[model samples]
Target: MMRGEGQELLNDVGCICEENGALDLLQVVVGKGDVYDGIWTELQKDHASLQAEIGYLLQNQQKFDVNLNVRHFGKVTKSTIQADGTLMDAAEKIFRGTIDFVRGSADSVGAETEQVLLLGDDVVNKTIPVILCAEENVQGSHGAAIGELDEETLFYFGARGMDRTQAENTIARAKLEAKIQKIGDADIEQKVKTQLAEVLDRDNR
Candidate 1:
């Protein structure tokens, strides 16, 4: 987890998986600041696998950039998920990801997905997803979603006595909550939820 308060942050991460091994990672960031996050992962042997998920919520005049690189050295599986939300026109974000299937990485499978929610028009969002394959039997896929809330959805929340901002906050919270609920430790999960609620309340204020 990472948080920033009007300062710049840079997070660089690397991971390697050996033969028949697996790796899983989750990263979350929230606040009003500038952030640049980069991750590089390699599957070094047959049957190795890697899974990584990243979530971020930025409000006010914040900027975020994320980059991910995955290399399949052998037959392996790699998957990545990126979920991001921006609540103000001054926020900006960019996501860049790449998956490379090397020559010996036959039968390797890789997938990447990114979802972004925009609450205002002046927010800047850029996404670049790439898959490069040198093996004949490799499979790679990527997809992304970037948009604002629909009027119908807003109306549904309004009917429940929630204003437009409240509805948008609820939707954004759901994205992070989905991941938080997956924590294996109940105590940690609850603690995170509480902290998240406090943060959301502060932001709303």
Candidate 2:
């Protein structure tokens, strides 16, 4: 299902399993011009049922940059493209994050992209899934890859300025803001922003 502008949209992007089964899902989020800035969210629930308990979770996140005509300007843009998939009977779960960018103006060319992936429970037992791809085309093409923060990075931050939890909160806030900017309503965007801020604060614990 899909939700349009004006009406706030929330959807469960994933499904659970009662018995063994296969599931496939994909999602695409685009950031457009002035009238298109708004927040969008997809929640996936993997609850176990009676008789037998099985569950799986998958996620994907990607960010792309667009090159518009130089004459077209004054617009706010943001997007959170997420995918979730799970296989029942086998009890397999997957979580992936992909961020792709087509950054920069055509005149002064530059290329950069980034991706991140997250998996849980059954997913960790499986192989590390693919996170990004660059179609053979040159115009500033590169993706800065980062996995979830490592313990060492957290420790380093703790020793310097922030506690481990604080470091995590900082990163989460940055990402949440990027997603909200895509939410297309000023009032709604602000509401989601404040709600996200509260979530980040709680995570700092």
Candidate 3:
């Protein structure tokens, strides 16, 4: 977890997977802040694998940049998920992800996905997902989706008597809530929800 307020926050992570080992990592960031995050993973033996997930919510003039690098030295698997949301003008984000399948990593599989939601026109979002293969039997894939709120969805909220700003806030909260819900700790989830409500209310003011 990280927070930024008119300043830059940087994070670097490294992981090594031994024979028959598996690693799972999750990173989450929130608020109107600037952030840079980088993660590197290396698979050292057969059957070693890694999974990583990152989530970000940026509002106001916040900015975030993320990089993920994975190298498969043996038969292994790598999977990554990145989700980001931007709610106001001047917010920007960039994501760069790469997976390398080496010669001995035959039969290895790598997959990556990135999703970004935008709520204002003045916000900027960019994503670059890459997979490099040095083995013929390896498989790699990546996908990305970026968009803003659709009119029909907003209209449905409007019919329920919620204004545009209210509806947008709801959507933004939902995006971050989805990530928090994955924590697998009921007590922690409730605590985070309480903090989130305070943050959201402050932002509205």
Candidate 4:
């Protein structure tokens, strides 16, 4: 219905839109270069009743990428990818509502998004490889964090019993475990657990 920002919109590649509703965007960011590389396949039958809302908060240096695919019948297909890579090449997405046919992956198919966050003199690097897809009858949502400890959360943990290092380790391990459980893949889950344990042990050393 209404599109703003006068931003250069890419096509048939990184992120594409083929829908009927107005893409109400507010200060979205995207990476530069040949970022688009796929033809999104969406069904066109259930139109008129599609809605989406997106919000992104990012901080980084490298490039960021996003791809979306949405379909509806008897109406039009809609796909959107909005982001702000202001601080860093941060990747984010928000999907709320239903779909007739769903396909494709967001969070970079075969690329790795790495970021290094610094606190005082301590430096830690984080790399996140995310591939998310969902089939919803009504509504669905997805989110990710591919970085080190949060200052506030770490402070809370330290205030309780852990030192800075111990708190970071504990929080990192817990985050990994939660991510593994969300995936629900046993093999990968065990691998993540082992890696988290190693990281935690190293923190003590």
Best by lDDT: 1
Ranking by lDDT: 1, 3, 4, 2
Worst 10-residue lDDT window, candidate 3: 78-87
Candidate 2 regions with alpha-carbon error over 4 angstroms? 1-114, 117-146, 203-205
lDDT of 3 by residue, 1-115 (tens): 5453667788999988888888787766775468888888898788888878777667667778888898988875555555555446567888888989988998788888877
Looking at model 2, residue 97 earns an lDDT score of: 30
Candidates ranked, most accurate by TM-score first: 3, 1, 2, 4
TM-score of 1: 0.89
lDDT of 4 by residue, 85-170 (tens): 11222322222222233443222111112222222223222222233344333222333333455778788987898887667455
Candidate 1 lDDT, tens digit per residue, 1-205? 5454668888998888889888787776665468999989899889988788877777666788888888999775555555555445457888888889989998889888888888887888888898998898988888888788999999899999999878977988898888777667898777777766755674453
Clash counts per candidate, in order, are 0, 19, 0, 16
Least well predicted 10-residue stretch by lDDT in candidate 1: 80-89
* Superposition error at 8 for model 4 (Å): 29
lDDT of 3 at 164: 83
Q: Can you give the lDDT of residue 42 in candidate 4?
A: 42
- Name the candidate, 3 or 4, with the larger TM-score value: 3
Evaluate model 4: give its lDDT: 0.34
